[model samples]
Target: MVREPSDRSSGPEEQEGVGEQDGFQRLWTPHRMAYIKGENKPSGPGRDDGCPFCEIPKGTDEDGLVIRRGTAVFAVLNLYPYNSGHLMVCPYRHVADYAELDDAEALELARFTQRALAALRKASGAHGFNVGMNLGTVAGAGIAAHLHQHVVPRWGGDTNFMPVIGRTKVLPQLLRDTRALLAESWPED
Candidate 1:
């Protein structure tokens, strides 16, 4: 029921059917549909409302993709990463805003973030990093019920036509493998 563009001499503008050839091969990423449909996303602004950051620590490290755990905070790989080895440092307590962090939580969060960067560098040889928090829903926080700082690894020429023109990112490694590598590469206290 599908016809290639070469089947007809006419251009795409003249085609009329369900399978209209646009002259470009598609890179189907059906897995992205879960993210697009907001699966596993929290429904409310509470820990009891299925906050992933709150529940992640309860599971085993490998199951949760957690790289390192601190007294007040932990580092875990982002399920939908912007790049390979992209991880977030999150406080154990469920707090929506950065100002809500206490002295101990703040200190541990900072230390965990530093350790995340070091582990990423050692594990993947990341050239640079994009580190920051989205703050709130309006500020681009996917899970606005909990505060988390992202540490996205970047390399030279990492930004290419795939994400720019095609609106897709090509991650080379699996989340579990990346987590294990980062956990091993994490620095000592």
Candidate 2:
């Protein structure tokens, strides 16, 4: 004799604790709303339209997520980081192209990038780093109008199926917390 499937087994919702349990856990990150909403995006390349890089320096270091400040450049935590200690080294000038940087800015940019990596290593035990610049909008720069070099700290097994499958990056630490740690470990002078 043939039997029909039970009505209660129609879908996962009907099963006991089955709908909520797929053997995978989730980490809700509602704080990313500002980035998603483009809250601090520059209206134009000019500093007048409220460029984040320019405005950041005006605020307190902790409020700005700044880890270190140099003469011509500064290191700040990436608002939407690729990893826990992701940093962006940016020149104070609001120039879009790397070639536009003055010699002082250029030198400080490199110096800040190195310093950022060192601080990340000491503070977070980073095993590797991805440090580079995304030159333009077409090159994957989120803020193309302002030049910034990304220094993303990486560790073994840091990459997982989450980003590929869910289109989400899970950062274990908060930006402020990471900033404080890096700031504490920042190189003197």
Candidate 3:
């Protein structure tokens, strides 16, 4: 295996690049982009988007595995889930931050979250979950353009050698099967 860089190579390699350091020199690297915005840029907009969360429908489809859809919110199966029944909730509007969500949109989001949790519980016997959002790029938002909440189901003893030793998460059920179960048991609000 290749070894990590030593102190000597790091210094000379940096200088040889014509001293061409960028403002976000330490922020992003080709190997791994730090999700966070750097000092040169503003922190976050926390605002709506022209091509943000609202664009989920353009790619998401029920037959392809969407679970539920509401007036202002929707839920879908996560292809890459932490467990068998991981899901995601997004608002029809593609805005970041809790502040921009109005009364109706906020209520819909909350209601849909509840529905997703209930369905996951019924489908996979999941009594607990880890639901959250990574607001900015630095916060681990893979798609920073659109903000959404992740509802990860958990069971006792679910953390096993697969994730730790193998560095892989294994789902017991297929994405389609999980989708069908959740779709059938979706709680109507």
Report the C-alpha lDDT of model 1 over 1-189, residue by residue, as the tens digit.
Answer: 455556443443545654466666566778888888999898999999999999999999999999999999999999999999999999999999999999999999999888888998999899999999998889999999999999999999999999999998999999999999999999999
Ordered list by lDDT, greatest first: 1, 2, 3
| CA shift of 135, model 1, Å | 0.8
- Candidates, ranked, TM-score: 1, 2, 3
Per-candidate Cα lDDT values, in order, are 0.91, 0.85, 0.69
* Clashing pairs counted in every model: 0, 0, 3
Clashing pairs in 1: none
Give the per-residue lDDT digits (tens) of candidate 2, residues 1-189. 333435334445435644533333455677888888888898887888889999999999999998888889999998888889888999888899999999989988988887888888899889999999999989988888999999998999888887878778877777888889899999886
Best by lDDT: 1
Clashing pairs in 3: 35-137, 35-138, 36-138
**Model 2 misplaced regions, further than 4 Å:** 1-26
lDDT by residue for model 3 (1-189), tens: 334333443333256434533222232233222323332122345333234344446665655467888887778776557788788887777676767788998888888888888888887888689999888788886666565789998898888876787665656677888888899999776
For model 1, the stretches where C-alpha displacement exceeds 4 angstroms are: 1-17
Q: Give the TM-score of candidate 3.
A: 0.69
Question: Residue 138 deviation, candidate 1, in Å?
Answer: 0.7
Candidate 2 TM-score to native: 0.83
Error of 1 at 50 (Å): 0.6
